[model samples]
Target: MAFRRYLKPRVVPQEVEQIVDALPHHNVGSQGYDPWGLNLDTAKISFTAVRWLYEHYFRVEAHGLENVPADGRLLLIGNHSGQLPMDGVMAAYAIATNPHGPRLPRTMVERWFPTVPFLGNFINQVGGVVGDPKNCGKMLEREEAIIVFPEGIRGSGKPYRLRYQLQRFGHGFMHLAMEHRTPIVPMGIVGCEETMPSVTNIKPLARMLGVPYFPLAPLVPLPAKVHICFGEPMHFPDDARDEGEVERRVERVKDAIRDLIDQGLAKRRGKF
Candidate 1:
C-alpha cells in the first residue's frame, strides 16, 4: 500500500480519447506482416493505452520531434535506463505520439524480453522483435522505423549512481545503417534513470530467473517525469564498409547522444 503513493495520476479519459482521435490513421501492416509481425489493429489499440501512460501518467514531454524524419527508414538509437521497461516504452510511445504523423517504431527487444509471459506477446503484437541481425536487416530492407538501445542489458543494469552515464555501445547499428543507407536518429531519455533507481544487482537471483542483472530497487517506480530528445538524423554512405570507419561512426553517434543527455539534464534542473 505504501508504494501506491508512487503511482502518478492517470490521464483523464476524455483527453485520452481526444488524443487517440487526433492520431494519424493509416494501415501500416495492412499489406501484410510489417517488418516484424506487427498487427496494425493490435498496435492501434495498444497505442491508446500507451498514449495514456506516456502523456498522462508519466507526463513525458518530448523535444525535437522536428528532427525525427517525417518519413523513411530510420534507426533510433538511445540510452537505455530504468529498472523496468518503462524507459523503452516511454521512448516508443513518444515516437508513436509524434504529432508529425506519429511514426510507431519497431523496437528491437532483447531475446529474453519475449519470454516474459503476456508482456512479451504484447510487445510482439505491436511490432517488437528479438534483437537479431536478420530481423533488423529485414526491417531495414523494408524501410521501417527501428528503435535500438546499443547499450543492451548492461545499460539497463548499471548502479543507480551511474545513472545517465552513457554505456559503451556496440558497433553493429552503424554497420546496419551503412548497409541499408538508412539514417540514424540519436535520442536521449532523461528522468528514466531514477524510475526504480537500482542500488545493486541481485546476481544469483537474476541468474536463477534467467534474466540479466536483477535491479534491487523500490517495489514501485518513482513518479519521475520523463523527457525524450531526438537529435538530428545522421546518414552513412551505403557503400562505406570499412570496420574502422564503422567504429568511428558509432563513437560519433554516442557523442551526439551524450550531448543531448547533458542538455536535457540541464533543462530538467536536476530534479532526479
Candidate 2:
C-alpha cells in the first residue's frame, strides 16, 4: 500500500499527470484498464520516457494540431519512416498536447510487434493494438481515435535513396474509414528518414530473424529535428464500394500528406 502511494506521485511527474488526467479516455473500467490493456498508470509512466525524445532529443515541431478533433471516432493517417516507430510516437504526443485539448489515440501496430517479448505488452498498455481491420472497426464504433500507417513496413523499411517517396498505400484503411464513417487527419512527418538513414536492407538477416527487413543503419536514431504537419480532417462518402474508387480516395489522402511533407521540408532550416 505504501509502495503504491510512493509509485504514483513520485514516478509520474505532476505535469504529465495533469496531461493524462485532462484527456478524455473511453471504455476504461474502474480498475483503470481498458479492454485493449490500456492502464492509465502505465501510460503516464511511458509518456515520461517518450516525452524526452519528443521534446529534447528529436525537437519535434507540430503544426495544424487544432485540425485534430478533440473527441470523435477518427483516423490519423500518416507516412511512416525511420527504422523505429518514432513518427507515430511524436504524432501521439502532439495530439495529446494539442492546444484544443488532450486526446489519447490508439496506434495501430504491425502484427509482428507483439511477437517481441515485453515490447508488445508495453505497447498495448500505452494504447497500441494490432493493425487488424476488425480491431479498427470496433474502436471506431466506440468513438475511439486511431493512428494508421497504410504503407506498413514498405515505408519504414525503405532505404535512404527512396526517402520522402511514399510507397503504395493499402486500400484497407480507406475501406475501414468509409465503412465506419471515420474522418482521417493526414499527417506528414519530415526528418525521420534522416534519423537512421538506412543504406540497404538486410533481407536475408531479416528472414533469419523472422522480422521485417532489417536495415544497416545507426545503432541508435540520430537526433534529427522532426517536423509533423497535421492537415485538416478529411471525410469521404461512405457509399464507395468499388476497389478503384477506394484506391482513388486513398490517393487523395496521400496527396494531402505529400503536400504537408513538402511544407515541412520547406519549413526546416537543415537536417540536424
RMSD after CA superposition, every candidate: 5.6, 1.7
Q: How many backbone clashes are present in model 1?
A: 0
Among these predictions, the greatest lDDT belongs to: 2
Against the true structure, what is each candidate's TM-score?
0.86, 0.96
Best by TM-score: 2
The sequence of per-residue lDDT tens digits that candidate 1 reaches over residues 134-175 is 888887776678899999988888888998888889888888
All candidates' lDDT scores?
Answer: 0.78, 0.92
Candidate 1 residue spans exceeding 4 A from truth: 1-35, 239-241, 270-272
lDDT of 2 by residue, 142-244 (tens): 9998999999999999999999999999999999888888899999999999999999999899999999989999999999999999999999978876888
Candidate 2 has what TM-score?
Answer: 0.96
**TM-score of model 1 relative to the true fold?**
0.86
Off by over 4 Å in 2: 1-9
